[model samples]
Target: MTDPKSSRLLDNRWDDAKAAGLSESQLLLYRSNLLGSDKRITNYGGGNTSAKVIEKDPLTGQDVEVLWVKGSGGDVGSIKIDGFATLYQDKLEGLKNIYRGLEFEDEMVGYLPFCTFNLNPRAASIDTPLHAYVPYKHVDHMHPDAIIAIAASKNSKELTKQIYGDEIGWLPWKRPGFELGLWLSKFAKENPTAKGVVLESHGLFTWADTAKDCYLLTLEIINKAIAWFETETEGKAIFGGAVTQSADADKRKAVAAALMPVIRGFIGKSESKVGHFDDQPAVLEFVNSADLRALAALGTSCPDHFLRTKIRPLVLDYDPARDNLDEVLATLEASITAYRAGYAEYYERCKHDNSPAIRDPNAVVYLVPGVGMITFARDKATARISGEFYVNAINVMRGASTVSTYVGLPEQEAFDIEYWLLEEAKLQRMPKPKSLAGRIAFVTGGAGGIGKATAERLIGEGAVVVLADIDEAALKTTEADFAKRYGADVVRGVKLNVTDEAQVLASYIETSVQYGGLDILVSNAGIASSAPIEETTLATWDKNISILATGYFLVSREAFRLFRRQKLGGNVVFVASKNGLAASPNAAAYCTAKAAEIHLARCLALEGAEAGIRVNTVNPDAVLRGSKIWSGEWREQRAASSHLQVDELEEHYRKRSMLKLNVFPEDIAEAIYFLASDASSKSTGNIINVDAGNAVSFPR
Candidate 1:
């Protein structure tokens, strides 16, 4: 149980917050504080917190309860009322078990009630159920540092008992949604006296009848754990040269005052609450300790903690004698490898069910030979707090490693947290997209015709396009043409053959770095080759598919690598042909390749949707302007061969489409432009027809 003395102030603070009138700004501040404490509880935009506010319902003719939770892309630390999507609490609760044994559109989860707001409220956070499950005026759910650290250890249950004693309860990580809520409710019933519950590998949950109580109780629990750690380690608090501070609060206040300006400038914010940073003397001394090299290896305790602490921190030590920076980095590399290998071994031994295995470390820690440790947090304050926690964790682990091997939570346990329901529920939180401004795009085969059109249109619409193609001369000419029209930086020319894996990989590396990162990929490169079915040769078929289909794969895969790493989300567009839908006589190999291209794009769309990468195909009918197979000589020969006039040949193709308008290269280009822009943000795995409606003659 928590020592009453250590938690006395926390309990008092709960009453104080409630008395503070819960203004909008205070509610936001309180939400930030509560969510920022745990990495899994919330990451860049993971879990959400809400306050029950009464509002008049337009349809009901009566005042009703509404919930205000963080909106689509808003971070909790500085989330305003605008960031929270206001919804009728009753309407949201009704969805808990309505569609049992079915999966509706994940995006539609909040659409029902969102349509009722005065200003269309943004989509609600996906884990709205978990937030709703807790019967509290103010609910706070965070993957707490102490809780995660313990949960991630091999003997997590034992660690929980040793550190928290009987103060907190534990819940096996389950998938989030109605099921998790049901699970928690059942567990709570079984342990009525529990202060809060720890969702394994997921996060911590602590709610009160009031927001203030929730906040204070959370701190009380954390402080109790901190005190226990200190007592076990006999860690001494350190204080450095100070201009003269009589009290601990005074010292912390001065440091916060100095640091606030720098942080504000870093984030471009003028107003921010400076959380008091009373760095433990033991932490400071440990950061300056001789074993700093050994301490830098521990990564973050959980996943999705990047927004706060970042992937890793620069560990600094003030000692000038620490000259082997390479050795320090090398040790870090070794530790990371060991960590992954250990995780895999744990998985092998513990995994007996069909559950998916852990993928990556949720967090990474870095120690500077002479500098202090840095921890990964999703926000600035969280990162700062993580640094404080890292020092403590480091001291304990170092001492513990000496006693017995510091085994992390076994594979099964880590997988439970990594794939925890609450964590997965965060995946369900799909925000309505805003504009595509500040995004980079790269279009292959972007010299002339459709390729040129795509590059030009994308550039005109505010995207920076890296126009690449195997035709070096064409690429240069296109670059010159666009540069003269849109300035040199609007479009850049890079010689690349998408069919060549090395070239494709190089192009991605160059473009990603030059553009800060890639946001859109347009695989518009393909050569047209048409022949009678029996006349098509193996070499010809291979050549067509290699560039038309496999080439798209290489470029798409390379883009996926960078997009996944950056986690900014991305879009991919394939320039398939109308031949994919309906084949014309004498076009066997070409039609086959085009059909394969459409299916490939669909599969990528399905796989990448979860990562926020939208994949779609643009199928345009025959555009005579730039196709290699539709030159002036060929057009005239085809007209004579078919015993029809040149004009008649063009007329026949144009009339094939329902729209009956000549489909130019520019027309196809526009379709690609729309797919790449924010205008079609919700579109994915869709095949848009730019054939002037010709391909619709026969539907799949």
Candidate 2:
């Protein structure tokens, strides 16, 4: 049992906000953070809060009321003052009249924008009117998981009454719109003593004259629901035991390695976009449970989840222990076909004329019973958000099942929200994503200067990148740094000695399992060896050939196998040097290895042409800045050979180029990105020289 005193402790912490004499808007912001900071209260951008404050109307020189509400797409936990959209109260209240007669589409396009008070252009949340209609000075709305468990239960009405008695108004599952707002407003008027309103199949709403009171009431009500659920479900066998002891790590990875690419290929056939995949522990637990099919078939825990997870997750028939890869993939294909057919029928049964065009029938979340759950989206961020919500939904549904039967919104109600104009507009409002939004990229030598730069560039363009390098320490540091910028899901690090065939093959398999498949492979790993033919030791030549020549072959071979299996065209980029095209004196081993690497790329290009795979090479010359090849004794020898000081070598290289520009790591990175992207789609078996203007090294 949660201590009731714990609720008091939280309330006491808010006394500091009151002591600071915060303005109404500031208090609302502070409390919004307080509510949003707790995942139990809201997840991601799931909730909104508002404050009614009196402000001077600049044009009229009179004090008028304004509703400051959480702006669209703004998370309450991190919202600043500007994150709140300000609206003229009198103007917005008048919208209720126009809303009554206007169609939902018309209201979204015409009326919502006209009611704004401030010059800020962010669209107010769709739930704006719900806050405007409420008479409280402070109102908070949250989709607390605990409350959702109760609100989505079959016995929600009776449960609501038992929990809050007449102090709370229970509104049935009505599609959120002008009508719903009006109904809630009317209910508050009739039930004047009610402290909050519970929207069935939705969430909770609490209000008070002060932000502190409103916040405390929300926590109080949510705690009540939690206590009730804990008491009711105690000793109940709600969750089934695991179907089998969790598979060993290698087995789980092998299952993902075999299944994710095929699933990705199947889904990609329906849409010509990049795909994303995730396999978190929560997903594994839920999917591996014996009751997965029974629980998942019941649909999403709430209507709002449909926006992220869809109506139902597609459950594939997969048993890691008994099923072979080919059999699992075939079964998955048939399951997807059946899912589409069922989705089309469901749409026909529920869709109205105003409904938006049907979205693709592919399920966002796929449950592979023995392996885990994999979520698909157009980008990594959305896939992760969908995964997070599904995990929460699973927990809520499990709790609801333990107490009373779990019940989601009816199909028509889900359709009404899923295709709602306001919801669709919110998605349309987002800025266009980068060109490589859902693509996966693998960079060898990723801990080195050029490789790190290329990985960062790919991530900036929105590709999920896997950084593989023999240097484990550097690889870990680079991964951690990239995670700080993009997120852990955006960049993964793998220790890879590219010359080791087993490690090379395992890296590709891991990439396929983690991100469905690879689209771009930058084979940039190599070692620099400079020696005259007579003086060159066998060790020098062998080491250079092993990493520079043989490493490229190993990694590329694995990449080719996976690309052929996926049947999706991919890009391969070889990072050769200008010396490869025009040899430098005393650089026999290095030049020979690079020349071999370049030729290997052309051969792969010819072999991959039929599969639509494009192979290219980037030859960068005198890349002194951040170039590991130009460090230590090699720098002295190269400078001595050119009869220049160590520091002057960079200037010499700069002047040597026709453009007289210093070639930095980023310059090489740009060339690699161009070749990897669709910009060079028509060009393959091509070499891009990043040597400024190397007339001698320029491709014929």
Tell me, by TM-score, which candidate is best: 2
The parts of candidate 1 lying over 4 Å away from their true place are 1-48, 72-75, 99-120, 158-167, 174-178, 235-299, 306-322, 325-366, 372-700
Mind giving the per-residue lDDT tens digits that candidate 2 earns over 1-700? 2456544222324667363878888999989998988777887788899999999887888999999999888889989999999989999888766554435534643576787885768778777878888888998889887788888889888889988899777988866666766777898888889998888878898999988888888888888787777778778765575784456668777777777777677777644334344456766777887778888877775665768888899887766677566776767778888898998888899888877788888888887765666787887677777877787788678777778888876777787778777677767878887867778999999988899999999899889999999889989999999999888888889999998999998998788766778889999986786667899899999888999989999988888887777777889999999988997898899889999999999999999999989999999988877766777678888888888899899999989899999898999999999999878999899999999898888776
Model 1: lDDT to the true structure: 0.60
Q: For model 2, give the RMSD to the true fold.
A: 2.8
- Stretch of 10 with least lDDT, candidate 2: 4-13
- Measure candidate 1: CA RMSD: 17.6
Whose lDDT is greatest here? 2
C-alpha lDDT values of all predictions: 0.60, 0.82
CA RMSD, predictions in order: 17.6, 2.8
